[model samples]
Target: MADLHRQNEHGSRNRTRFPTQPTPSAPAPELRGHGLRLRPWDAECDTDVETWLRGNSDPEFRRWNTPVKLVDGMEDARESLRLRAEWDAEGKCVSYCVTDAATGAPLGHIGVNDIDHFIRTARVGYWVLPEARGHGVATRALRLAARWAFTNLGTHRLELGHALGHDASCRIAERCGFLYEGTLRGAMFDAGRHDAFRDVHLHARLATDPEPGEGEGKGE
Candidate 1:
């Protein structure tokens, strides 16, 4: 299972065939709700490049996530965003730059990745910037992205995994109605180390699961 996860593909006995209707609806619509707007990451935009670099290079974010190709500097950040945009173009993932709905300032990142429409499942991950910590930015972004995934991608299941001790992320998952599923041993690279591995606490939410309460703003 861990190996399959690493490949970004899920194996299922169901053998069901779902139409390739291009999940994520292509071009990735802006998801606005609850004082947050999730827009696609743009490599050509300077603001996107700076925020992408800052967020991805942040100590706190690196403590949890290690991209397959590390963003080492400004050019790397632009390339990273370029890859995200390309992945979305290929309908393999939908990445978003989470920002304040009113101010349009980048506050974090959230992505519904490895979308398998036939299996109707995808993985989700997020990080809150230092300035945005303790303000529920991650929670809000997760909910908005989840809602968008289910609606636009027809995604039946969304999976979230965090390092075993990431209690804050676990709580955010729970708050968004993603119930604890199980632990995947050595499912991810250990914090700041590509050579070591760490266990991941898995959580999942079904399309039919009860929705989280609507908070401050209406969905768009």
Candidate 2:
């Protein structure tokens, strides 16, 4: 297990505070899987990241990403990087940029937000570049993050939420071994419509569950 308190030398950079959110910090355990690396969000990767997101932000990819307004330039990525740093510093959340191991290209982003350490739980979210979708990049990155969380952060369980109509995300949650907990009725608002939140299936895996191993049995 990697040390949660230890900061990587590469991640050391000044960060600005979000008005209501804590600053982000380095992720624990420095996870890697499926030809991808998940590391703490850093400012140095700004150019690579902006390019990735710019090319990946399509209507197909943004349908479920209602919470994050799409940015039009590199400054937005810079601000997000700063917020990630603050979140890490305050331990309020942890975020990572998914990158290709061979080419070092930023593929997407994922994170555990709204974390409550005392409860040993957190919500997981992710987005893969449009071209990178259907390649298991999101699943690989998510499982790696969960492994780090449980093994290093003392998390007993992990939770995920997807909009009711997003069947793809639901499938990913199931494949990852998260049990469907239940739905929150009328709990979601998207695109100016108040939609009935699909029974937000709450799938969870214990720390002791068998590791599925990278890319093994992953759905296409």
Candidate 3:
């Protein structure tokens, strides 16, 4: 049989056009502060299927926030993992699983997306599991993530937006030191309201602003 590989002009075997494997990356660093720990997605151990499925399926969550579609089984979880990994690899977004510091159980999820390095800005979003709400989990996690974004990733401005009716989310943004900017009319899609579009309240925090006390790190 003829050789399957072709020789180039230099008389060396030419590599295949398509790679058989994905390029490896350095492991993402884990960020910890306050009462929470923020870790990169790890499907094997960190896949909180029940929490994810329930949180995303809530009609209130779907209406007030950009929600993940309902998930029914393992296949959906795997797809979610694949998409998250793609986002992390592309540097387009950095997502974290927020976990309790002492117990190591997942409390929720948070991320900074829409990264614009040229403008040194990004959009932040988060969701707390139903059981984890009312304990300030989102606020602490946001502060830790925001500090990392500003100090480590060179992000100068972080933006957060919530549906106008989400008073809890607005409070979390405020607790994390993000100032209310303005409202955008018909800027969001709310699924539970039978309305395709709804107004959103905008908030932002800048690197030059004072950091939230909850996330302040002790000198090491």
Look at candidate 3 and give me any clashing residue pairs: none
Instruction: Determine the C-alpha RMSD for candidate 1 after optimal superposition of all C-alphas.
Output: 4.7
Best by TM-score: 1
Residue-level lDDT of model 1, residues 49-167, one tens digit each, is 98989998998788888778888788999999988888888888888999999999889899989888666889998887888887789889998999888876789999999999988
Per-model TM-score on C-alpha atoms: 0.87, 0.75, 0.79
The alpha-carbon deviation from the true structure for residue 91 of candidate 2, after best TM-score superposition, in angstroms, is 0.8
- lDDT against the true structure, per candidate, is 0.85, 0.67, 0.74
Local accuracy of candidate 2 as per-residue lDDT tens digits, 52-141? 456435566556554444555677667666766777778877878788888887777888877766446678888877667777787778
lDDT for 86 (candidate 1): 86
Model 2 spans with C-alpha error above 4 angstroms: 1-29, 48-57, 68-70, 192-199, 208-210, 213-220
Clashes in predicted model 2: 21
Cα displacement (angstroms), candidate 1, residue 201, comes to 0.2
- Taking the tens digit of each residue's C-alpha lDDT, what string does model 3 give over 1-220? 1242233223445533322111235444688988788988765543565556565665556767654344555666656766777877767778788899899988888988887664577999988777777788888888888888887777889999988888888888887899999999998776554447788999999999986666432210
> Residue 172 CA error for candidate 1 (Å)?
0.5
Better-scoring candidate (TM-score), 2 or 3: 3
